[model samples]
Target: MRKTALFAALSVTGALLSGCGTAERLSRIGRAPDMAPIADPTRDPNYRPVSMPMPAPQDARNLSANSLWRPGSRTFLRDQRASAVGDIITILVSIRDQAELQNTSERSRENSESMGIPRILGLDSSYARFFPQGFDPSRMIEANSNNGSQGTGRIRRNEAVTMRVAGTVTQVLPNGNLVVTGRQQVRVNHEMRDMQLTGIIRPQDIASDNTVQHDRLAEARISYGGRGTVSDVQQPRYGQQILDAILPF
Candidate 1:
C-alpha cells in the first residue's frame, strides 16, 4: 500500500511539473523576443528581407573629371548622404491631427385632400344629416407629417514621438533611393520599450546634418511597442482570452 501511494504521488508530481513548463512557455508570448540584432545581412543564417516588388538595382556608371556629380559617388569635398547599403542616418519622428463637424436639419409637411358633394348632386344635405358635426366631406382625407434629424461629430487626436536613432541603410535602389532600417530597445525596471523602422528614402532627403524627417520617408513601416511584467499584468490571461474568442455569449 505504501509503494502504491508513493507511485501515485510521483505521477502527480510529474504531471504538475509538465504543466508548469507549458505555462511558462505560453506566458512568454507578447513579451519581447530574444532582443538580438542581426549579426550580418547577407551572411546571416536567417536574414532575408520580405519578398516584395522593389526597384531594380542600377549598375555603376564610369565617371570622368568632367562629371560634376555621378550617382553613388563619394566625394571628399561634399556632405555625405545615406545612399549606399551599410550607411547610417538619423530620423526625426513627428505626428498630429484634429477635426470637428456639425449638421442640423428640420422639416414639416401637411397635406389635405377632399371632394365635395354639391346640393345639385343631391348628396350634401343627406350626408350632413347622417354625419356628426366633426364629420365633413370636404376634408375627407388629411395627413400631417413632421420629420427632423440633427447630427454632430467631432474628432481630436494628438500624438508625438520626437527622438533620433541611427539607422543602417539596408539596400540602395536603382534610382538612388536607400532602404533604411533601425531598431532600438530600452529596458528600465523590468519594462522594455522597443522602436523599429524600415523605409525607402531618397539621397537628397537627408539633410546636411545626416538626418531625415519621418514624414519624408516612403513605404515607411514604423512600430512602437513594449513588453514587460507590467504589460503582461495589463492583458487578460490566455485562458480567459481563449474563452472570449471561442465562446458565444
Candidate 2:
C-alpha cells in the first residue's frame, strides 16, 4: 500500500512538471539525444539530453511471402510501382510565364498675384520720396510661379522551360507520399548545365510507366540553368552593381 501511494504521487508530480515546462522542452527541438551510457535524470546531474518528436521510418512488408507467381496468375502481369525509397521516377518539367507593365505620371501647377494703389488715396505717392526711381508699389505686390513633372516606366519579362529529369525517392511518409530529390549535371565543350529538383509525390500520381509530371508534385522546387566562361563575360562587374545600388544620378 505504501509503495502504491508513492507511485501515484510521483506520477502526479511528473504531469505537473511537464505541463509547466512546455516551452523549456521545445528549446531542445533540434538537438540530438544523449547517446550510449544513457544517464538517469537523477543519477547523473551533469548529463543532460533533449527529447523531441521525429519522423519514423516506413514499415517494409514482404508481399511475396504469401503471393505466388503462377504461369497465369494476375500477379505475373502486374506493373512495377515505385512505393519505396531508392525507387526512381521520371519527372516532366514544363513551365511558361510572361509579364508586362507600364506606368506614366504627370503634374503641373501655376500661381500669380498683383496689387494696385488707388489715385484718390495718394498712398503710393506718400512713399515716393523713400522709393527707388524705378520701383513700383503695384509690381512689389505681384508674384507668379509655374511647376511641371512627367515620368514614365515600362517592364516586360518572359520565361519558358521544358525538360525531363529522373528523381529517386529518398523517404516514404506514413501517408504513402514519397519525398524525392534529383540532380543532373551535363558538360558540353566549354558550357555546363546544372539541374536540381525536390518535392513530395503520391504513388497514385505516377503513370503506369513510372513517370510523374512536375506540376503534380507537392512543395516542388526545380531549378535548371547553365554557367561557363561565356556566362561570366555576360555578367556585370561587382563594382558596377554596387554603384547602381548606391548612386542616384
Candidate 3:
C-alpha cells in the first residue's frame, strides 16, 4: 500500500511539472516564437577554453636579403582569412549518408536418455510388488528433450542535410588550430528551427572566400531540430512515455 501511494505521488508531481511547461507553450499558441537576444558566447557558464597537444617550437628561419615574403607566411600580401580569436568565418555544412544491414541465425538441440536396474543383487524380483504391472526394469527411467530457436534482424537508414552559417573563433590552441562555435535559428509561423555547430579547424583549410567545409572540421558536433505546435502534437504524452519507460513486458 505504501509503495502504491509513493508511486501515485511521483506521478502527480511529474504531471504537474509537465503541465507547467504545457501552460507556457499554450500561452504562445497564436504568436510567433520570440527571438533570443544576442549575447557573448564566452560569458556562458558552459563555455571553456580548448586545449590540444602542441609540437615543439621551431626557430624562425631567416628570410633572404631583400625578399618580400616572410617565413611561415601563407601569402605575400596580408591574409584576410579568420586566424585570431573572435574572428568570424562562414561554414559550409553538407552531409549525405546511407546504410543497410541484415542478419539471420538458427539453432536447434535434441537429447535423449534411458536408465534401468536390470539386476540389483537378488531383489529384481521384488520390483513387481512396488512397481506397475509388467514393469520392465531394463527401461525404468527415460527422458527426451528438444529445443529450437531462430532470429532475424534488419536495418536501413538514410540522411542528408545542407546549410551555411557563420561561426566565431572562440579559442586559438597552442598548435595554432582554432575552436569555432555557431548557432542559427529561423522562425516561420509558429515553428522555430534551430541549428548548432562546434568544432576545431585549421587556418590553412579556410578557402580564399573565408569559408571552410564541414569535412575539414575535427571533433565536430552538429545539431538540427525544431520546436512548435506540430512538434508537440507529434510527441507522445508525458504519462504514456513514463509508463513505456517503467512497465516490464
- Give the winner by TM-score: 3
Off by over 4 Å in 2: 1-79, 113-126, 129-140, 235-249
| RMSD each, Å | 9.0, 19.6, 3.2
| Arranged by lDDT, best first | 3, 1, 2
Q: What is the C-alpha lDDT of each candidate?
A: 0.71, 0.69, 0.88
Structure candidate 2, residue pairs in collision: none
Candidate 3 lDDT for residue 210: 88
lDDT of 1 at 113: 53
Which digits, one per residue and each the tens of the lDDT, describe model 2 over residues 194-233?
8878788878888877889999988888988775545545
Question: What local lDDT score does residue 211 receive in model 3, on the 0 to 100 scale?
Answer: 96
Query: Against the hidden reference, what TM-scores do the models get?
Result: 0.62, 0.54, 0.86
Q: After superposition, how far is residue 35 of candidate 1 from its true place, in Å?
A: 2.7
**Model 3 ranges off by over 4 Å:** 1-15, 60-65, 71-75
Any runs in candidate 1 off by more than 4 Å, and if so which?
A: 1-34, 40-62, 65-79, 97-135, 236-249
Ranking by TM-score: 3, 1, 2
How many residue pairs clash in all the candidates, one count each?
Answer: 0, 0, 0
lDDT of 1 by residue, 1-249 (tens): 999999998678656645784576477766543565755444556545544465667676677777677654466555477767788799887754344455555555555555653444666777757776656666655566555555555555657676677788887765667888887888876678888887878887888778999988888888988877676678775556657877999
Of the candidates shown, which would achieve the greatest lDDT relative to the real structure?
3
lDDT of 3 at 232: 82
